[model samples]
Target: MNTLYPVMLEPQEPSGYCVQFVDIPGAITEGETLEECLFNAAEALTGVIESYIELGQEIPRPSENIKEAYYIAPDARVQSALLIRWARGDRSLADIARALETSWPSAQRLENPHHSPTLKQLERAASVLGKKLVLSLE
Candidate 1:
């Protein structure tokens, strides 16, 4: 099953943006663009879920009051940051591909937000990134 949660997008000082989970405290992410910020927020949420699961903890569900302060299209900065973190963390695209049982190029496509990754693929990518996928209604 797929879970979609409500996330709040807030603009930050200087440049870039940040995301906040309505139900999860300290669960935040930022990026140079709205797309990147949102995507990173998703990934960050996944990671938080994974950590909870690993520790046999409970996951936080989204609240009914979820709302977005702003709206923007996808951006490349999010993909780049995700890729950079994956690389810096010594996480290989090939490894993620293998974990998701996909081809390297396919995995590469996922790293590119512009490629339009499916929810399942994103879930797998999150798993490979040591995260869990969750979606909740707003």
Candidate 2:
């Protein structure tokens, strides 16, 4: 499932915008324009959640009435794929590893945000988990 994070954007004094995510503490960024703010917001949110996933911490649910919602994209070849797949309760690391054509340790590392995986490998793992990985540029 795709996770949507709510962000609060405030115009900074003089210039730029300060972006803060409600559910993701320590996730803050700034941009000179709305476009840039939106882009940075995605990056910040992704980074926060990816860190949480990497640390095996909880991913917070979105709060109510979030005006600006950002999509979570911690890179398709990163831990987000493994987190999503595991969250589905459809398979174990061993099962996903076999489908990914890699070792179990590699499969486990696929869930580590600090460890990058090949996009092809993430795609294969997503397929095995019955998910279609969608990636886009802002």
The best candidate in terms of lDDT: 2
Cα lDDT over the full model 2: 0.69
Pairs with backbone N, CA or C atoms under 3 Å apart (clashes), candidate 2: none
- Clash pairs, candidate 1, are 3-135, 3-136, 4-135, 4-136, 5-136, 46-132
The TM-score that candidate 1 achieves is 0.47
lDDT (CA) per prediction: 0.59, 0.69
Encode model 1's per-residue lDDT on 36-135: one tens digit a residue.
Answer: 8777876776666545534535455445544543322223333332432344256676877788788988877764433556677666677767666564
Alpha-carbon runs more than 4 Å astray in model 2: 61-65, 68-72, 76-91, 98-101, 134-138
